[model samples]
Target: MEDQPEHSVSNEKSTAVGERQLHRGDYGAETELQRHLSTRHVTMIALGSSIGMGLWLGSGKSLASGGPVGIFLGYILAGSMVWAVSHSIGELAVLYPLPSAFVQWTGKFVSPSAAFSLGWAYWFNYILTVANEIQVTSVVMGFWTDDLPNAAWITIFWAVVTLANVFGVKVFGEIEVVGASIKFGWIIVVIFSLIVTSAGGAPGHGPIGFRYWNSDPFTHGFKGFLSVMPTCIFAMAGSENCGLVAAETRNPRRSVPRAVGSIWLRLSLFYILGAMMVTINVDPHNKDLFGQSGTNASPFVIAYREARLPALAHMMNAVILISVVTTGTIYIYSGSRNILGLAHLGMAPKQFKHADDSGRPWPGLVLSIILGGGLAYLNVKNSSADVFSWLSNMTSLFTLFGWGMICLAHIRFRHAWHAQGRSDSDLPWKSWTYPYSAWWGLIWCMVLIVVEFYLAVWPLGLPPSAKNFFSNYVSVIAIVVLYLGARTYYRGPWWIKLTDIDLDANRRFYVDTEIEKVPEKGLRGKAEKVLGFLFN
Candidate 1:
């Protein structure tokens, strides 16, 4: 890729502003992302990001905690929150498509310090996520090979992902597409089989319609449902990554809106329906089975085994492994890109701007691999998975924080648009219900954050478990300390002025006319169209 003028920063001003401003590199006129990320890749990324081992491994916990009713309602609540957040992100993405996306927008609407805190928090969250996924892959691998140490497996997996990333973004996207296809296909089969078996088509069982329900329909009650909200939110976390890639998308204006609009349907069909199938097939009260199975236990696997298809368990495990790897790879890719964006904005070291012939951020990718691998090694050395749990919980917090920032950014972006006397139609993508959707998403995120802190800090009369309490609270505390430390060093006041925010700097690279295609009529039309369909 030819290096553009906007990609280079001036060296003369580097020393004048001091290291902090120097680190906040220029928000260039152009971003160094490839347009190779097509609509299918983008959509598949969003799908794959949300549908991970979490669904397979974590769903049982959610079901056990909330029962059928809690599982259903918790997912619905979290899914709706994700939907609104996706829409809010879409609006900002259309208006100002940047690589950092929400973080950059937050900086523009809030403060540089706010952006700094939010950006690093998110980057750290993804790093921890990348580490957690590595451990998860190791755990899954150990199911087949008990001899190999998990640390060794994690190191090997990290190296493979790092190599894939170094090859280029296109290669990374392609691998993810293939990985996503396997996971998505497996889920479809599982869902179908579930429906068939529930209808009593199996030879021995007959129809098992709601049999598990009568056993313990409301097992966990309200608290159980609330308890599982963190995992549910984690599953739905990546629904908005589409907006993050808008700057690199062929037609972001059109594609992002289309992708955002589909969040509701996807969540309903993929998550809600999939969870319901598990609930119908497996009894949540079967603590004995769960205890024996542990993390290797997928309700779908259990159901398949019970239905005389024990081999399906192996297939599902393989698919889950692939899903974890894919998600881990994407997290590393995203984390590196976030670092590159930060580098470009002078928020990080300038070395991160080093891109190869394929425009891959080499330095950023290397750093992520090192960080991810190091974290994995640390977890193994500690002989405690509690660090992983704590990191995962903190990730949930940061993810919520990022979502809240997106809504706040959208609100400010709209106000700026109105202040400039631009009509809503003038924008490339418009969010329905205006400020209300944005406000609702923001409020919901704030509520989740508060609740997460509460759950982390106080037991609310639950058993006095040190592991449970610290695992929950440490993340929140760590993030606050990091944010405050960064702000203090920068000499920034707690409150940031909105006028100082640079909302429009990174938006100049977007080409609005590229994504004007209308929605296709039938299935054939939709199938025939490629990347453009994402926008439609």
Candidate 2:
């Protein structure tokens, strides 16, 4: 947070000079952010961000509110939204390869005021996510014992994440690759365990073949289904962080597309199918599904506990702890870069843009730690489940709003491309679904936001609570205030004209370089290709 820059009038020509003047002051000439992340590193970063606590801990609430069928549908709808937004972001990032990703694009393609809202909104989203990850990590630890306080565990992992991010992008990327690989393997184990236990393969369980669904498919009916949308949105929040790191990757043109391409597989295998298995093995109406102590909240753990498999339950909890801590590291890495991007665009203080020789934005990193890490102390005063509920609600709302803006920015970019007489063949990587996918993402995201509004007003089986209403809708209110305040201070237009949009700034790096493709030839090559296909 820095003071707003004073607005100034400029010419309305199609030249770079006019465009740069219209978008705050000229873009900062120096950007010391290094491109150190490899293809594998970037791919797993995307995977690691999305495959964390939302599925492990928060799914209990989803299943409790909406039964088996309701939660399944929620995952499908939310997965589709993530897919559409991923392609939109992929196409834009490959073309622009800029420092801030879609946040800066809103200023260039839409308006400066919109970019101001997006940049700060996205930064805050990650900050809240940081706290959410920490709280959940403590909850996961409860599965073992409550020997130490949640606050003690919070401080320990906070230091771990902070140290990981402080060393620069290379260190962070390496850690993510390892952490994400472990998580990937653990999910496969969980899915297989669920399959086995559901078929009566465990010691003391009868066959569980859709028995829960037969009893009650939809727990609370249509309203209950609507209530799960926000949690679904929260579950998929970090998938977009892949494209945001384009500026820090070694070869964004190749790495970003690979990362984006694999998102569909991740969603289908990890989220959608994972939901199906959870509902099959664990009863949605079980009282253990609503545990507030976090010890028995995860349906996956509950399923194993009921099946007489304590050892497996313990193993699953251990991996969940690792996954939560890994996610915390990602939020800090992404949050710092977001603020750095804001500074580069002249939307924040110049000092925030400062980077060390190793390309670490120390100032922004410190601020992220203070604000995001500080929020974890809320668990000291309230139950872990209560803290998780409100934090997830707030973060999910912000994510849905940010996603809608991303799709809008993409649509506007296409308009500007055609208006400037640019050919589609000149593009390095094209979004196969173009206008249709962008529209799909935009409309559905808006609908989900509206669903969030409805659920906030009347929570599942309870009257409207002032605390609940604000906890869920505060993200919407904050963004509106940020947008109006920036717009008033800058005296900018509501939207940029298509003909005057700046489509060429910071794009020469991607447009001028030829895409080099290496052919696969030997055993090593084949092995590498298989790994790339699976991860990248």
Candidate 3:
């Protein structure tokens, strides 16, 4: 659905005003991006991005090491922290609705140097994520047959994703809507099927009611549980992408909050409960869960096979293949947008900022696809183990770093709001937890960083290796170098003062006033009523 103006000004005028406000600083004139994303688009994009390879494949790793109890608890802890971050971003996005979300906001509310560093680091993280997913696609395809080489599968999938993204935001939104629906529907089916099979309802299975947990709830021990935390965090890494797309969302004021609000449900149903079901259905010590079997070793697949449903197992693999491809597409979309945002901030070349008539940042998009797809070729050399491991380690750390910066930005934003004498009532959407929620997210991000570093130095099972340590902690070094280098070059304020923030810049004027909802009166009305919580 196209966004209708809530006030007298046309969409074009409102966009022009927003661009003018954003151009007030040294960043110069900002380009306007078309807001093509609808409520369903934003919501499904966030859902599709979050519920991908991490939950499908990485959960097997977590389950093997941490066991049933460890992963469950780890997900709880991580889910709480992620919700805090989501809420913080939702509030900020509703008010600011900037293209790059907190990456750019860090400059306005925190420090320009910080934004520069965070933007590049986070952009790199997405690029690696794209490659990682593509690599996994090879493994997923291998489940069927090795008729094609790994590189061939990689090339084919990469081409498909590039084409999908070439058509612009509407196509991206539609792809996500379809992909997320399939993923969501399959997960529900798998969860229910697991429950049934565990109850001896399947062809050849006896009741398996929490047998794994009863025998070995914590596989390795406390240390093993600690190892699961990072995986849990990675599972939900892209949850915040909803905020990044807010600027391109047709009605962010109404859609963004609803999308963010649903995150808690996504976490609860998808990860927490799904993890619980996996533990109940499959033993933690199941050797086929990981290792030599690869992505085909997902616990859900194992569960289906155990229930004597080989056909369904194959179907599940197909769904997972689609899920991985969709996620790679999202990472590419997000990476290109990040470049556009960097250009808007004058951190990247102006050429990268050029958007086609359809609002596609074609230059950045091509660069992102080339880099992401190019990196996937590392698998052909049989060196993906080393290359992708380093990439994984760096991306995971950057996820925490990005969240920390976002929380920090939200804190500064609240400070500016109060310092400027703006009432809480003026906020389009207020975070009920406010200071406490942002602090929770910020503190937990720091704690996870320390924990991840500790895990790197002395990994769960193996003796410490300098190589392993650096591989895990390398992103820290990268972030530091980027921050210091940008800090030196920009030579802006070391920190932005609360009163110095341009709070009014990029603020959506339409949201500040009340708008009436036009009630529908047919099948659409019933669907709207059913999904009412998805919009204001």
Model 2, 74-176: lDDT tens digits are 9999999999999988988887766667787777787778888989988999999999888666778777778989899889888889998998888988888
Quote the positional error of residue 227 for candidate 1 in Å.
0.9
Residue 37, model 1, lDDT: 70
Clashing pairs in 3: none
Error of 1 at 463 (Å): 3.4
Give the TM-scores of the predictions, in the order they appear: 0.86, 0.93, 0.91
Lowest lDDT sum, 10 consecutive residues, model 2, at: 6-15
Model 3 CA lDDT for position 493: 52
Q: What is candidate 1's lDDT per residue for 443-528, written digit by digit as tens?
A: 98889888876676554336657777767766666667767766655554453444444444556444535553434678524532
Candidate 3 lDDT, 1-536, residue by residue in tens? 25665564554553343233234653322455677877767777766677777788778878988999999999898888888998899888887787677778887787777888899998998898899888777767777888998899999999989988998889988898789879877888888888899999999679999888889989989889988887788778898899888888766777788788778767877888888888998888777774424443778888888889999889988988888889999999999989888888878888988888898999889999999999888888864434544566678889999999999999988888999999998887887878888899999999988988998999977799998898789889899999998766656457776876677766767743544343478853554464565434
lDDT of each structure? 0.71, 0.81, 0.81
Give candidate 3's TM-score.
Answer: 0.91
**What local lDDT does model 3 show for residue 428?**
74
Candidate 2 regions with alpha-carbon error over 4 angstroms: 1-30, 290-294, 508-528
lDDT of 1 at 412: 81
